[model samples]
Target: MKRRQIYFILVLIACNFTLGYAQNPFEVIEEPLPYSKKASSFTINIIGYNEDFVINEWQKYITDFSGLTYVTAVNKGVVEMESSGVVFPLLNDNKVNLYTRFAPNKTLTGVLLTVWVQKSDGTFFSSESSKKEAERIKDWLFEFQDKIRLLNTRIKYQQRF
Candidate 1:
């Protein structure tokens, strides 16, 4: 390959990597609930760079969230609205985004708990607040688990591997 062509390919790859690292403008950066009890409900919001990208990401986000166990429904909408109900306050009012409402009495906790895909530059972002919320939301989860090493019989029984 020509040197110029090789340089172009390298630049493209770097851009993609950077984009993956950047948060999705249309999506909220969420941390997985610390407890996997199942969420009472959750909303996944994704921002769009344009009409086409908005529709495209909305579709992909739904498809991905649907595979999860506790996602009761995926709410789709544009980012232009003053309030995106669930996603607005959390996403800092990005122009394009998507959100999903989780079911009641459930939790999620683990590595890479919440992954937000931002469109501004196709990057990813996360936060401690999101993790704290996930932990808080666990209280509402039906099958939720307590992190504390309680001595109660039930907790002990459940703790046994």
Candidate 2:
């Protein structure tokens, strides 16, 4: 009798689990980005260059290097993105609103960068913030100049292929 009861209990438990799962046939969960958005700006002044080359290399660099590749946006002269890393202590983040500009027919110019802490009437967001990301952004733009130089050499050899 005891053996039969034990077997009965096990079957009941198994049925409970199966039914619970069946009730929710299709359950889906979406995840958020690992890092919080902080704001910063950086520039590289390589004037009189081809627009196509500039945008392409930047897309490759921004999308390829940062862990935020899945969420990063690389549009014409504007990139809205994030980098995954340390969380910041501040309540809110300094959103990295990266935007770019180009001359219609190659106006001569260079690049610049700036960073700041946002004013606090803001709700607490620093908890979700990623540290050193802004610095890394500056570095990304800094590296961009070099990528263009290398690209230029490749283009020279390829003769605009």
Candidate 3:
């Protein structure tokens, strides 16, 4: 199953550009909708690019931001990154692992990407709080998604005009 996933992942791609102004060559599939507190995973689509382009974008996004992210794993085309100690404005201090998987789009445009939070330590002294922790995770994921969305907008606008 793992090998099969890698096979499917090969089609998703990202750009080879450097950090600073680099944006993933992608378009948002949909906006994030409401999910229950128990919900952890959020699926977003990055369509209209080649296989390797999207994947490259993800790798650069994670690695280039040295202080913000730490690369935990990169297998096949799956990238697992852990957040730094920077606590967000959420109710608690909980560091999170950002897990992302990309599957080739059936339409042959881009990829179906699912990103989620898992296996985390309470940030800023490691205080364990379930309620606050869950909210923190969701908020952090949304913030990350928004960053990508903004970047995609820049990419499209610049490419066109």
Candidate 4:
């Protein structure tokens, strides 16, 4: 009887660990960037460039990166938006929504990137599993900026020639 009880206790402990391990501990809450919708938004300026140019560059970058799709692209007047709302509501006008359907076996993740041309600032929101993923997005943005810089340099070089 003692041996049987010990075996049962071990099985219970194992089951608990398995269930806990199945769920991811890190979760991203849905909320807009800068905390509030009424608050002033931030900007990531590409000096000497207009809204159209920045939008084009971002589209190109998104295309080159696999697993990212343009869920929505709205350019109404001065505001611009790009996102895959099917997966999660990561960015609304004033809230950061959660993506609860994320699975460990899934290979693709969705992202939302918005830009306000008139203000010259943009918002980038996504559900990231780790700090590395956030850093990767930042690095990609830097790469996009580098591409714009190269293009500008070439234009300047050609004008000089």
TM-score of each: 0.21, 0.37, 0.41, 0.41
> What CA root-mean-square deviation does each model show from the true structure?
17.5, 19.4, 15.0, 17.4
lDDT of 1 at 35: 44
Off by over 4 Å in 1: 20-23, 29-31, 40-161
lDDT score at residue 20, model 3, on the 0-100 scale? 23
What's each prediction's clash count? 52, 12, 13, 5
Local accuracy of candidate 1 as per-residue lDDT tens digits, 34-97: 5432322233332212333333433343344332222333434222211121232234533322
Higher lDDT: candidate 1 or 3? 3
Candidate 1 yields a Cα-based lDDT of 0.33
Better of 1 and 4 by lDDT: 4
For candidate 2, write residues 120-143 as lDDT tens digits.
Answer: 333221223534443444454556
**lDDT agreement of model 4 with the native:** 0.41
Ranking by TM-score: 3, 4, 2, 1
**Model 4 lDDT per residue over 1-161, tens place:** 99999999999999999988755422322333456443222223344565556556665654443213342334332434443322211222222211111111122222222222111133333323233434433454455567977987898999998
The local distance difference test score of each candidate is 0.33, 0.43, 0.51, 0.41
Candidates 2 and 4, the one with greater lDDT: 2
lDDT-based ranking: 3, 2, 4, 1
